[model samples]
Target: MSISPLKETIPKLDPPNNTSLHPPPSPSTHRTLRRLKSAHVLGSSVSQPSLISQQHKQSLNRNFSPTRKVTNPPPGAHTRTRSNSDANVMSPALSSPISRRPQMKRASPVEGSTLDRLIRDGPTEGDLERGLESMRLKILDQGVKSDGDGMSSLRIYVWLVLLNAPVLETDEYLSLIHRGASPAYSKIRNDTFRTLATDPLFRRRVSEASLIRLLNAVAWKLHDAKGERSEVQMRLTNTANIYGSPELQHATPAKGRSRATTLTNDGSDAGKSEPGTYVQGMNVLAAPFLYAARSEAEAFIAFHQFITTECPGYVRGAMDGVHKGLALVDKVLAIVDPKLSLYLIGKGMNAELYAFPSVLTLCACTPPLPEVLRLWDFLFAYGAHLNILCIVAQLVILRNSILNSPSPTKILRSFPPLQADIVKEVTLTLVKKIPDDIYAEIVIHAK
Candidate 1:
């Protein structure tokens, strides 16, 4: 079957008539709302409620109130009390002042209709999940709008809701930072300087020192979790040895054997190498969170939640998840656009060679930081697994250029500046062409 080009114009829905609850939209804001109405997001018509009840709006307001107090610090730590207002206040040890960092602008309720109200007034408790789904739909329909400085006033909060990441206390994050450098601190230092080094926007917004702290904090969390898991595994193995038959006892590996190297069905030597607390390309993954977040703690919360939950396999021992994702990219391409797949394979241009960074960093490796943020809005909302399909979408976009080139590797060497809308549209189209079984694999490949 052949794929057809998508229409440039997407149909728009009428804005809800409720003007009393939400502030009226300015001319520019009206244009943005109209664009949002266009079903270009997710490529389907979503019927939104015409009006949110007053009580629901109140519930949303109460949910995000800035009056909450900070959690108590662990014993032997600081005893001073703090509030949500202090969320942005960072410890001197955890951060260094960047001369060029721009002042963050908070999203205003009067900015736009849906997102503004959601940001100003959070979703109701009973409708929390549904509200998040609504936010996702809005984000898909209308991306998180950022300023010229490459900052989105509300993108971080939207991501927090979509990822189901709870509000981490400032003290908790500081406590992690106070632990000093992690075991992987030196390795993290080596990678942080090189992260997004060439992107001016990234350099202007995020600093290497901030990146180091966020990554090292995450390393400490992962290290501690690994220790706990090893302890549990040791106990289980001991229990088995004490109760099991002689053959079972003999089959159990020695206690010091590295569990990180255990083999899987794939032929990769995941079992041969020892896994470390930190891995390469993580700096790229953490860059966006730092860029979007208002404070380091907020960034840490979102970034830590993302790695630990969304794509743990990508950062785990041998990074088997990334390999699996890379393999799926090849399989997905073959299935969706066999002609292009055959052409690339004919030239020996498998995704493993070209798409590794995209898979490992969720396309953060691709340039135009703004577009990367837009793409992530979609990924965080729906599922990160669809990122595999998004990579295929990029290939499909470059189908002709790659097909006609004698040296396709040159064209595939680096992806063109991210065109988030086109890629998302193509990705949604390709999603239909994928078979259920393969699609199922895509969904869980990251986990």
Candidate 2:
């Protein structure tokens, strides 16, 4: 089915003339900087904003240094001041405002294990794919372990391998964050606070500042890409007009109308607006990466790889990929469990009404955050398209309750908090039941 483009105008995000690419930090940031400087780790201080709160610092410590025991400071600890000389003698981790957390310990693979060798040796693209298949099977049979709070020792590296995410430098991500907020800054701020808002596990571990920074950095990247694409399109349009191409003439908007207001054969506005630079559900999508990643930059790399490659359509104008995925959810559910599918449909319930968040966030919206992480382990392992079948599996698991309920919508309004193991089991079974054609559609629905 053809999806109509959204009618919104793309906002220009070019910085003002006086604004430098690397603007000086604000007063609060300066205080943070001084704190880092005092800790004698000036080099690492530039990696993140200095304004990281005390709570966030502890959370980071907990997530990355899973084995370290964090002790509380004595009362009136905030009132004490340290001299530069005294700070120099203190350990960097103890003195720095944001402690340098250690990377999670890698599981010691068997001496000759294929997965260990692949990870240690860094396989080529073809070899990596083969390695990932082995890894996928291992993950399916024995799931990755995580702290109850969703922090995993090895999950981020696995996700990076599965996504084939490039090795991004800390400076590269810092540069984006240093660019300050993008045109979507206000929109991003609005959604960041609400992301995984009700989940204590997520709330405690991820700082609002960190989430805002990651999303804003992503917005800037998207904004820059959109600008480049627009420039190329404009150049092509100009060249076409100069050549007197009939197709160009037919496609050009009228003098009185902007391209965004132009109508197409589908009777819908043929707008220039691409997928949004910052959409609402993106905060949810980015949350898991931040929760899983060892650092913001690591999270940025994985999250960027995911949106740009795995599911570009999901983030595009009107989230056409997500809508497509939703429709597929209904179809897959019918094939796997026709009784539940028809019962829900007869009650005027459909995937569109209930599965939007699940579709858009890859089931991250449902929580018990650790379970979400486990489910994601599977998604990143197999194929993300399997999430469609996973959603169907959720329905199948809940079939008894839904079929019996007079109002089935209440049961489906939210999936019973994600049961990753059972969901994966049902999903694999459902995968076998899907016809080849429908399964093919499931595979590419997010693309």
Candidate 3:
């Protein structure tokens, strides 16, 4: 997949078993989060005015944070060039009025329990001890009945408890983790200990000092973009990174696209229903992912929060319309091509939004940054394809459950925000049941 292959056909690489991990950025993909950083590579400007960076070919990590309030796109900017060298593409443009260019040059640890739990410590020693104890009990209980599927099973149990907290007792759920209710409950306890310590929600209840203290446990990841090799530092191993063919990267989103006008989406027309399908509240086009109703709302709120409080530069990126337009294209493409879908999940790895510190790790509750860098290496290899496909299929897969699931709350707890594992699992399975020709059919348009 050479960048020079201006107009080339994408190959079909379908096999079967689709195993996904970390469903955060449910509405976005590994690329969406990672793309926010500075890519050293340069593309042949599209059309709109864009800025040219001298830092092309730099395969390093660069964080571009804006400090001002989010503003409109820069008018009359130079167009961003597209290259055939990356899975997801990038170029330079105006900075957001509120862009803070916070160079988190210092790589932190990955902050989740499932993969690499780098503990930075959250508030009281008691909190830490309790959280750890809670996880330990969870592991033992789950492990008691099986050949070691405890932790995985416990993950589901946690999701269910969190999503459908019928009794709404945090301690009960916390107790579930504290006691040996399920196999590997201990592991969940350990992981949750770290997560709860750093969890913003947890911190909110705790003192501000505790929240800041807990963040130290937070880690960072690396992103591979179409930038200069020296610029986009690669961190985190055994994860998804989106620096494949540049043309594919830029084209994957195929700008000028719009959100779903095909049917009643979001809460707007959820009232209307057809025979086989009913309307759900999920916002299928949220940047991080197409999610169940509440998730969509959460994501929208989170994104707006990010746009306002975090990355003002995003508006600048949006100005090129690359962020918003391309994102919309990516969303549309996700539906059109499974491979191009947006779910970019990394199981048991740091779920950093991008592979770089600049992108600002954005998964709901996953591993930290440093460990996430490891994951991006793999992500960048095939991330472009996975970026579009995963997100789209996730929507398709969830559309039914989201729209009509008996227990809608379970949607959030049932799984992590991202669904990379599902993609790997489904693709591998499809390979066997599906003939080569069928894959070819999908791949043809996947480009």
Ranking by TM-score: 1, 2, 3
Which sections of candidate 1 miss by over 4 Å?
A: 1-113, 241-276
Q: Could you report the Cα RMSD, in angstroms, for every candidate shown?
A: 15.0, 15.2, 24.7
The estimated TM-scores of all candidates read 0.71, 0.71, 0.23
Candidate 1 clash pair list: 60-122, 261-271
Candidate 2: count of backbone clashes, pairs at least 3 residues apart or interchain: 2
Tell me the tens digit of each residue's lDDT in model 1 across 180-202: 77888878888888899889988
- For model 3, residues 1-447, the per-residue Cα lDDT tens digits are 111011112223233223443333221221121221121211112243112122123243211100012223359742232111111111112221111111112122223432112011221332322332233222222111111111121122222111111212112111222222232222222333333244343233223222111111110000111122213222211111244332233433433121222211342232121111000111111112111111211222222222222222322312221133234323343345444232332111111222111122222233332222222211222222222233334445565564465443455342334444344334333323333433333222212
Give the per-residue lDDT of model 2 (tens digit) for 319-376.
Answer: 8889999999998888777887888899899899999999999999998888898889
Which wins on lDDT, candidate 2 or candidate 3?
2
- How far does residue 299 in candidate 1 sit from its true spot (Å)? 0.8
Error of 1 at 11 (Å): 9.3
Per-residue lDDT of 67 in model 3: 9
- Candidate 2's TM-score reads 0.71
